[model samples]
Target chain A: DVKVTQSSRYLVKRTGEKVFLECVQDMDHENMFWYRQDPGLGLRLIYFSYDVKMKEKGDIPEGYSVSREKKERFSLILESASTNQTSMYLCASSPGQGVVGELFFGEGSRLTVL
Target chain B: GESVGLHLPTLSVQEGDNSIINCAYSNSASDYFIWYKQESGKGPQFIIDIRSNMDKRQGQRVTVLLNKTVKHLSLQIAATQPGDSAVYFCADGNQGGKLIFGQGTELSVKP
Candidate 1:
């Protein structure tokens, strides 16, 4: 079974602080995604990287950025965290073209920006 | 704009009863669809998936039905159990591989 591991299960930060959420996938999947899950809003994509050193902005990318320096690791950075940014962050990976969009997800990191 | 949305926000069913969750998508060009189950404090888990060409697919105790013409999708669960209670989301994967998720349906199973 494929495993997507998240570095932190829960985090709390003050406003204007910078936060880093890390994720790693065991399988050599080509696509990695970061999403934020909010009540009533569902899961909104933050950023996605298809390969090393490549990243694309998703629907909601403001105040957030991502890094994919290696095949197995992807990181999401919150430049200046705010109270409004408090939400659950999810990391997912897929096998690109042949997989038909089935994403394996890690246990989400719940962020509470104070 | 393309979006995926669910018709109902919550569904309550008794144990041993069947449950149906409905979703509607706006993008006709979407080729792949998936159903996800998300428990509290965890990320969404893949339940099942159906391609555009196929109308129906079944998994253990779960079934996914897609209606391309109406752009509607449904997931049916047989003999609902307490463990089946969770938030369910339907996602659409477009040609570019970007996934759009629905608002999700919260399934509550009563004993």
Candidate 2:
């Protein structure tokens, strides 16, 4: 069984505050992703890392940044939190070699910005 | 930007009945697709997947059918149980592994 662990299951931040969400995967997958899910909007990709220290901006990367300092850990940073940035954030990982691999996800972090 | 979307936003079914959820993808270049189930306050869980090469795939109690011609995908649940209630999403990916997800369909299983 693959395990992806998130640092926080719930968080609340004030406007203009910095927020960090951490994720770690035990399966040694090469691909890591951050997504924000909203009602009726589904899961929109924020950022993804294919390898350690490598990253790519996803569809909705504005106001968000990510870090992949090590192979097993990925972090999402909200430079300045705002009410519009509040959403359920999810982390996922997948093997690098497969053509169409399934992503194993961590329990999401529900962030509320006030 | 390519988009993946669902036909319905919600579906309700009785326990022991079957449920079908539909999704549509706009990217014809997408070669792979996956179905996911997400419970409230939880991340999305992988259900089943089907490649462009195959039209159908089955799992323990779920089946995924893909129609490339219409760019449609469907997930069918057999003997729906309370645990089967969740938001279902379909994702399309090219060979590069970047997945574009659809607006999910929320399933409500009634006893």
Q: Give the range where candidate 2 chain B is weakest over 10 consecutive residues by summed lDDT.
A: B92-101
Error of 1 at B103 (Å): 0.8
Cα lDDT tens digits for candidate 2, B1-111 = 789999999999999999999999888888789999999878899999898999999999999999999999899999999999899999987735688888899999999
Residue lDDT tens for model 2, A1-114: 999999999999999999999999999889999999999999999999889999988899999999999999999999999999989999999997433479899999999999
Shift in Å, residue B23, candidate 1: 0.3
Give the proportion of true interface contacts each model preserves, from 0 to 1. Answer: 0.71, 0.76
The DockQ for candidate 1, computed on C-alphas, is: 0.69
Residue pairs with backbone overlap in model 1: none
**Which 10-residue span in candidate 1 chain B carries the lowest summed lDDT?**
B92-101
List the global CA lDDT of all models: 0.93, 0.92
Error of 1 at A28 (Å): 1.1
Candidate 1 C-alpha lDDT tens digits along B1-111: 789999999999999999999999998888899999998777889999999889999999999999999999999999999999999999998836778899999999999
Q: How many clashing pairs per prediction, in order?
A: 0, 0
